[model samples]
Structure formats: C-alpha cells, structure tokens
Target: MPALEITDLTRLYRRKGGEDFEALAGVDLTVPEGEVHGLLGPNGAGKTTLCKIISTVLLPTSGTVRVLGHDVVTDTHAVKLALGVVFGGEKGLYERLTARQNLDFWAGAYGLSRRRRRARVGELLERVGLDGRADERAGSFSRGMKQRLHLARGLVSDPGVLILDEPTVGMDPVAARDFRALVHELRDGGTTILLTTHDMAEAAALSDRVSLIDRGRLELTESPGTIGDLVSAYERVDARGVPDHVRDRIAALDGVVSVREDQGSLVRVETEQPDATLAVLRTLVDSGVRDVARSRPDLEEVYLHLVGRRGMGVDR
Candidate 1:
C-alpha cells in the first residue's frame, strides 16, 4: 500500500462576516512506501493545511486521506500509531523538561511501557545526536538543538511514515546539513517521508519526487531531475554593453521568452531553444559585445516561474 493517499481533499474555513475561504481544493496526492516526497508551495498555499489534515490534527471538510492504508477519518488510532509528525521551530518542546524527560513523556503517550520508554528515549537521543546533552533542559537548547529534540520526539513511536513541515527553517548551515543526513538515514531504514519546505535546494537535495501546489491547487508533480530538465529546455544569456538595436533584435528572435535589462547595462535574454540561445549569442558577439555568457535556470527559477512571486509568507 502507498504510505499516504489523499484524494479530492478540501478544507473550508468560515470567516467572521467575510467570504468563506477554501484552503484546499480537491487536492489529490499519493506517496509510496519508503519515498521522500517534497511538497513545495508559496505561503498560504495549503501546504500546512494538508499536513495538519494528514496528521489528524484538523479534519478535512471533504474527501479522504489514508496513511499506511488506514483512513485518517475512520482509523485515527491506527494512523497515529503509524505516523510521526515534526513541525519546524522550537515551540513544541517543554521548556522545563530535560531532553530525556521530554522524549520519555512522548514515548509514554504512545503507550510504551516504562522500561521500553527508557530504552527508546536513549536510542532516539543517540540517533538525533542529542545523547551528550540528554539531561539539558529543553529551554536551554539552541534552535538547532531544539529542532533535534523535536525530531527525537517525533520518532518516539518509531512510526513508518514521517511528515516534516519545514523541519530546517531556522537551522544553521551545518545543522541543516546534519539534519538532512539524518533524513537520508531514516529513508535508508525504510521510513516514508513527506517533507514540506520553501527551500528549493533542500527539496531538490532530499526528495525522490516533488509536488508543487499553488493557490489551493496542485500544479504538477515530478522528480527533481525531471523538474530540472523542464527548466533546462530554456537557456539564459546575459550580456553587457549591448546597443538598444541589438537588444531589440535579440528580443524578436524566435523562441526568445523574454529580454530584460538588469542593473546598469546588463541585458538578460531567456530563450526556449538552443538555436535561439546561439542566435542571441551570435548577435551579441557580432555586435562587438564581448562580455556575454549563457547558462541554464535552476529549480528556484522554475518555482518562481511556475508559482510567481507573491504571498510568500507563513501559511494561515
């Protein structure tokens, strides 16, 4: 069975004296076992709403969600038993409790016996690199440390499917790298993961496949390399000291997507075909423009092209 199955899922929020908002509109997604699926969307794009519904923290207004073959609505207990959820930031940990104590509490909540909880807590602390500071109060931990603790808490149940909602939001570069390595370890051990994040590099680095959501709808789902290939179909050429006539000529070339001026005298020409890019370069080089270069777009550029640059903030 797929690790997660979401079909025609929708959520509506009734506003006070305002029009009711539909956060998710008939979204459908399926994640297979042992795959790391990345969810990417702008702020207010229903990513968080989807995560909450899958975790059973919020009910969907319509449609069905299943985790590990257990329907979220009809089998909450089984879903909970099979899932682990970790949201980004340091807000979920108990301030006064030591790392060991916090993990112990969460394990107990999952019905682990006292002896089992002790063993599981220690195992988790070591797994997340918190064993050295297992006795430190959670409040005394740094943001990275707290995030590690959060991950440990999420694994207290040894769930099969894990959902990480921006799990590296405020982490330093080093910490983020370590966290990603840990995720790789989890996936290697046969854990299925659903990761939502605004970081394009992170999504590209860790995901086996990725789904893009926009304005309460899913736009596309593809492997990261496939997405890269989509953008690779287009090429960009940047040149300096190009005359207005050359710029206009490049703009009129076939397959040229756009020609825009950057800061100062630099002009960027985006083209949809290799011939177009070559033509652009030939035109510039023939015009005595010696400072021209060609390159391909990355995942971030594709995201901005697909989703546009607007409403990029925390989801409501």
Candidate 2:
C-alpha cells in the first residue's frame, strides 16, 4: 500500500477582491512505503497547500486523500497519528520553556505516558544533538537549535510516515548536513518520508524520486539522476569579450535554444541536449567566442524550466 495517496485534490478560496483562486488544482500523487519522495515547485505552486491539506491544517474542497488508509476528512486523528510533520520556518515552541520541558509538554499532549515521555524526550534530544542543551530555555537557543527542538517534537510521536516541508530551511551548512543525515537514518529504520524542499542539492541528494509540481499541477515525477538527464538546461559557457553577433550566432545553432550575456561578456546558453550543446561550443571556438566551458545544472535552471520563468521568484 502507498504511504500517502492524493486523488484529484482541488482547493479554492475566495480572494478579498471577490475572485476565486485555486490553491490546489486536481493534485494527485502516491508515495510508496519507506521511500523518500520529494515535492518541489516554485511559488504559488500549491506545494504548501497540499501539505496543509494532508497535515489536517487545511481542508480540501474536493477529492480523496488517504494517509495509511485513513481519510484526512473523516479520520483526522488517525491521519495525524500516522505521520510526523516538520514544517519549515519557526515553530510554535514556548520561548521560555527549556528544551526538556517543551518536549515533555508536547509528549504529554501527544498522550505519551510519564515514563515513556521522559525516556522519549531523552532519546530525541540526543538524536537531534540537543541533549547537552536540553535544560537550556528555547528562547536562548539559535535558530538552528530551535529547528532541532521542533524536529524532536515531530518525532516524539514515533510516526510511521514523516512529512518534511523545507526541513532544513534555515540552518547553517553544517547543521543542515546533520539534519539530512538524520533523515536518512530514519528512512533506513523503516519510516516512509515525503519531503518538500526548494534546495536542489538537498532534493537531489536525498530523494529517491522527485515530483516537480507547478501551479498545482505535477510537471513530472522522476528519479533525481533521470531529471538531470532529461531536462533542457541553461549551461554556463565560458566566453569573455564575445560580441553580440557571436552570441547570436551560437544561439542560432541547433540544440541551442537561447543565449544570455552575463558579467564580463560571459555568455550562457540554454541547451536542449547537453552533448549537442557542448558541441556548439566547439563551433564557438571555431567562430571566435572564447573559453567555452560547461557547468552543472543548478536548481534554479530546473525550477525556471519546470515553473514559468516570469514572476516566480518567491514560492518558498
């Protein structure tokens, strides 16, 4: 059975201007058990809306959602019980409470017994590396520490499925690395994970398969390595002092869709085929565009191609 399933999910809301806007438009997906699936999209792509719907924070206007065979609308409590959620951004932690106290409070709210609560709190605090700082007040901790505390809260339930939305959104590079390692460890221990992230490297590194969504529609779902192989990407070609005429000539070549001039007369071209694209660079050398080099496709390029390039700067 799938860990989570969504069939034709659609949500609409009335804007203040008296217009109805669709937040999630017939969104559909199925994440297999124990696999790490990624939800990726630009701004207003309904990634968060879908998360909210599944998390029971928001209701869907239509369609069916089943998390571990429990409907989000009908068996809300059962749905919550089956999953652990780590939403990106600041959590609703009590600022004045120590990490230990906060965990104890949430564990009690989650109905963990006094004995289990204490033991689980200790286990998670250590898992997130906050055991040493468990006694310190939450407000005094850094943003990364706070995120770790929230992660502990999410796992205190010992859920079967984990939903991570931008799980490492605000941490330093080191902290983000640690958190990702922890995610892998959990998945190895048999927890199915569905992750939403804007970071390309994180998605590429951790996800078994990535579902790229845009404007509430799934663009394509593919393995990260396969996504790398099948997309037309803007490859940064090295050329300095290349005149507009030369740039235009390269753009006109087959498999070269567009050419852009960046700083210091460096030209970047969107290539349909990476191999054919690089071949065009040899032509550039023949035509006098200097120093053509290839760069790996970044998440920005992939996002721009999947999501519309116009006015899509803030979906996070």
Candidate 3:
C-alpha cells in the first residue's frame, strides 16, 4: 500500500495588492511503503508549500492528501499520529532547553509514558550522536547539531511516515554521510520517508526515485539516472589536433550528434550514446589525436538543462 498519496493537490495564495496565485496546480504524487521518495526543485518550485500541506501545518486550497489511509483534513488527529516531520530551519527546538529536556518535552507531547519517554530520549540522543552533550542548551548548539536534534525530535514519536524538508542543509560532510546512512537504516526497517532537497547529489544518491518539481508542478518523476537521461544529453568529448575531415567523420558516425571546434586546436564531439565514446576516441586516435577526454551529464546538468533555461525565477 502507498504510505502517502496526493491527488490534484492545489494551493492558492492571495496577494494584498495583486491577483491570487496558485502555488500548486493540480499536482499528484504517491510514495510507497518503505520508500525514500525525493521531491527536488529549485527555490519557488512549491516544494515547501507541498510539504507544509502534507504535514498538516497548512491547509490546501483544494484537492486531497492522505497519509497511511488517513485523510489529512478529516482525520487530522489520526494523520498526525502517523506522521513525523523535520523541516530544516532554526526555530523548532526551544532555545533555552537542554537537548535532553527538549526531547523530553516533545515526548511528553506525543503522550509517551514517563518510562517510555526516558528510553526513547536516550535512544534518540545516541542515534543522533548527541548523547555526549545531551545536557547542553540547544541555543548553544551549532547549526549542524541543531539539525541533528531536529531529526531526533521528529522520530521521537516513532511515527511510521517521516516528512523531511531540506533535512541536511546545514550538515557537515561527515554528519551528512552519517545522516544518509541513518535514512537507509530507517528505510530498511520499513519507515517511509518523503524528502525535499535542493542538493542534486543528495537527491541522486539517497532517493529511490525523485519527482522533479518546476513551477509548482511535477515535471518528471523517475529515478535519478532516468532524470539525467531525460535531457537529450550527450557525452562531451574534447580532443586536440583533429583534422576538419575527422571532425566531419566523427559527426557522421552513428550516435555522434554534433561536433564543433574549440579554442587552441581542440575539437568538441557530442554523442547520444555513451557506449560509442570508445569508438569516437579510436577514430580520433587514428586521426593522430594528441589528447582526448570524455564527460557525461549528471543530475545537476539535467536540472539546469530543464529548469534553469526555462527562465523560472528563484524562490518567490
């Protein structure tokens, strides 16, 4: 069964001196049980708005959303019982409270028994690598540490579904790696996660599949590799000392899309097929090529090719 489902979800915002605007325009998406589904887009793509509506922090203007069979609007209590949320920003935890105290407070709110709360708090502190400093006031913690606490607090309820928005924005490299591993662990244990992120590498590496959102709509939903392949990307081959005839010859080869001359005697070859890279290199070699290199498109390039060139402005 799908852990989370959204159908024709639309949200409209009214402006004080301007016309009403649609943040989400009839968007539809589903995340299966135990899957880490990523929502990716540049700022102003409605990623945050969608997440807020899903977590019940904001109401949608239209459409429906369900979490584990519970309607977010009609069954708000039941949906909240099954949902855990971690939105990347600085304000969730009470600044004056100790890390342990903060977790204790949230656990109490979840209605965990006193004994159960203690155990859960201990487990989460260790899990988030903050046990050593559990007594420190949260206001004294660094950005990354606070982010970790945000994660721990979300899971304090032991909810089945996790909604994480830009969860690793402030994490250091080491912390980021550990967090990714923790996400994998959660997925393996049957926890469903909906992650929103701008980091292309993070989305590419951690997501089972990604929904690429642009202008408040899903432009594509596929695996990272598939998204990268969606753009008509070519294997870029840079070679030096190639004759004009050789350039034409390379362009005429099967899978070779285009060829152009670069500064300082360099020839650029574009090919649709990656497997044909070796063949192109061989041809260049036969033509007495001096140097050659190959580069391929990744998720970042794909995003730029699709969204950036479309002239969509950054977050509104």
Best by TM-score: 2
By lDDT: ranked, best first: 1, 3, 2
**Model-by-model lDDT, in order?**
0.89, 0.83, 0.87
**Evaluation by TM-score, superior candidate among 1 and 3:** 1
Task: Single out the weakest 10-residue window by summed lDDT for candidate 1.
Answer: 307-316
TM-score of 1: 0.86
Candidate 3 regions off by >4 Å? 228-301
Candidate 2 deviant stretches above 4 angstroms: 231-234, 238-240, 261-267, 283-294, 307-316
lDDT (10s digit) by residue, model 2, range 43-144: 678888888899899999999899988999999999988878878887769989999999999889778999999999999999999999999999999888
Clashes of each: 0, 2, 0
Better of 2 and 3 by lDDT: 3
- Tens digits of per-residue lDDT for model 3, 70-159: 999999999888999999887799999999999999999888999999999999999999999999999999999999999999999988
Candidate 3 has a TM-score of 0.81
RMSD of each: 3.0, 2.5, 4.0
lDDT of 1 at 237: 92
Ranking by TM-score: 2, 1, 3
Write one digit per residue (lDDT tens) for candidate 1, span 38-68.
9987778888899999999999999999999
Better of 1 and 2 by TM-score: 2
